[model samples]
Target: MRCEDGHDDAAYVLGALSPAERAAYERHLATCSFCREAVADLSRVPDMLDRLEADEFARWLDPDHAVEPERPRKPQGRVKTFSVRLLSTAASIVLILVLGGGVFAWWWMGQQAPAEPVFGPAVAMSSIESTSPIAATIQLAGSESGTKVRMQCEYSVTAEPYNFKLIAYGPDGEKEQLGSWLARPGAEFSMDGGTRFTQGALARFELVRLDNTKMLVLDVK
Candidate 1:
């Protein structure tokens, strides 16, 4: 069976699909790289949900209770099945929350967990130096899996039509090409990129032209 547009990934990760459908998708995942990657990415949702405290899960499951302890009692017998159903419903709700927004929401929620901080606070990059008449700033924020980058650029006509790329150097001396976009002359542009470097792992970020000329470099301190 072929994977159809990765729609089964969400349902499969949430265990919402029928057994037959799940089996078919598993077979498809064996041969389809796209569906395999989708399943791998969506599989993180359960791990994120696991980080929530038992009381937090209880509150999510039963928000009406005002004075609940951290460790809630386990459901017994038939109530266990009911609890499973409740958790399944909660998973559906979460899937709906992330369906349009993408898996980033799941990781973002984990990082913004209430009990404790999963990542350090946001850090702003140093001012950039460019040869052309361009103004840009890059901000790196911590996430559960890595660092998230937000880049904004205001370019003069001199820099128009240039293919620009963002590269990040991690603390371990690993380099990653985050993304690339075209910079239209006399226009402002903003793009979002991500790297697999954890907090404090990113050493520097470079904005380079397609011809391999360096435009700007921001060092993380």
Candidate 2:
């Protein structure tokens, strides 16, 4: 039940372990962080199952396929049921928070979208002119110690009061989002985004607007 056991512990936690093996593994998990985290991740299943119909849960957690390769798709059925009832309720709460007394909440959401990138010669990013509200950059890929190439710049988009998207591109042209940020006239922001990559050459990171689609390249290394 060591972290090294990974999905192996997941199987054991699910009672998928053999009687003898389960007893041995249970002893091991008492002192294992990896097993503890795996169990927590799988614990989400009880609530998910409770939210699903009896038949749906039975079908989803089918014993023949106890080792599901991915998370189950969202539940689809009457919302009045305990399983699906909170789905829309949760979404409504998020929408309400984003509105949060803003007069233009509807308008802002209509024009907003996540960031997109065009690599190599196709990029046409405008220069950020504002020196305030410095942009944050993070290192997402590397060894467990998280060595990375990163950089920072200032926010200069006219799309006020909205966060920007952060994306990273490797030397070989792979792209991934680091996350998003709310723009302030003059402030500093930073975070550590988690991504896995084997040791390799350097990669590039960029910050782009959620609207207007502008981009600014940060430093590499």
Candidate 3:
């Protein structure tokens, strides 16, 4: 049989396969390492289910009993009884290890999962001289690659052609020019821009004109 047919290992272990199909899969298992490993892995599922059923039965039989002593029996073959008990104990240990390892793996995967992005509260920009009509707010969102910036600005357009420059200053004096834009005169203008700096690494954000005159500055903490 083709290796693709090995996908029925779960059904085979659960006794869901027909007699003919089970015979064919056993023959295929002899030559297919993938199917063999799949069978070994899935075999524990039935053992776990069986353990659960046994626990339920025991609980139902004696709900109030804390510890029950084994009843003495007539001397059956000592060696045969010893061997059976040893094999049963070994099987129970293997099942516990398999089920415990699976639970630990699931917990570890959950712990390592990526968290949702958290955004910092938007901080409003304050003018240095107190007479500047330019208003702005800056916000930062944490991401896997880097922190994303969102800057919103409201400017009083008094000059003829509005030539604006948005700059982000890093904590270490590194400066990045975000972008530039133009707006019409005698009208209130708003602009949106972004930068690559993380929120904590940013020292300040500034909006200025082409002539190097600072229009607005936001001190970051």
Candidate number of the best lDDT: 1
lDDT of 1 by residue, 29-119 (tens): 6444446655776677676664555456666656796864447677588987776666755755565456567465665567764343233
lDDT of 1 at 46: 70
The predicted structure with the larger TM-score, 1 or 3, is 1
Best by TM-score: 1
- Per-residue error at 202 for model 2, in Å? 3.7
Q: Candidate 2 residues 39-141, lDDT tens each? A: 6645544444344444443453355645345567686556536445454334333333343465335554466542332122222223465443344434333
Q: Which is the winner by TM-score between candidate 1 and candidate 2?
A: 1
| Candidate 3, run of 10 with poorest lDDT | 48-57
Error of 3 at 166 (Å): 1.3
TM-score on alpha carbons, each prediction = 0.49, 0.34, 0.41
Model 1 TM-score? Answer: 0.49
How would you order the candidates by lDDT, starting with the best? 1, 3, 2
lDDT of each: 0.67, 0.48, 0.63
* Candidate 2 clash pair list: 51-83, 133-186, 133-187, 149-221, 163-181
Candidate 1 at 26: error in angstroms? 16
CA lDDT for candidate 2: 0.48
Pairs that collide, model 1: 160-185
Question: Clashing residue pairs, candidate 3?
Answer: none
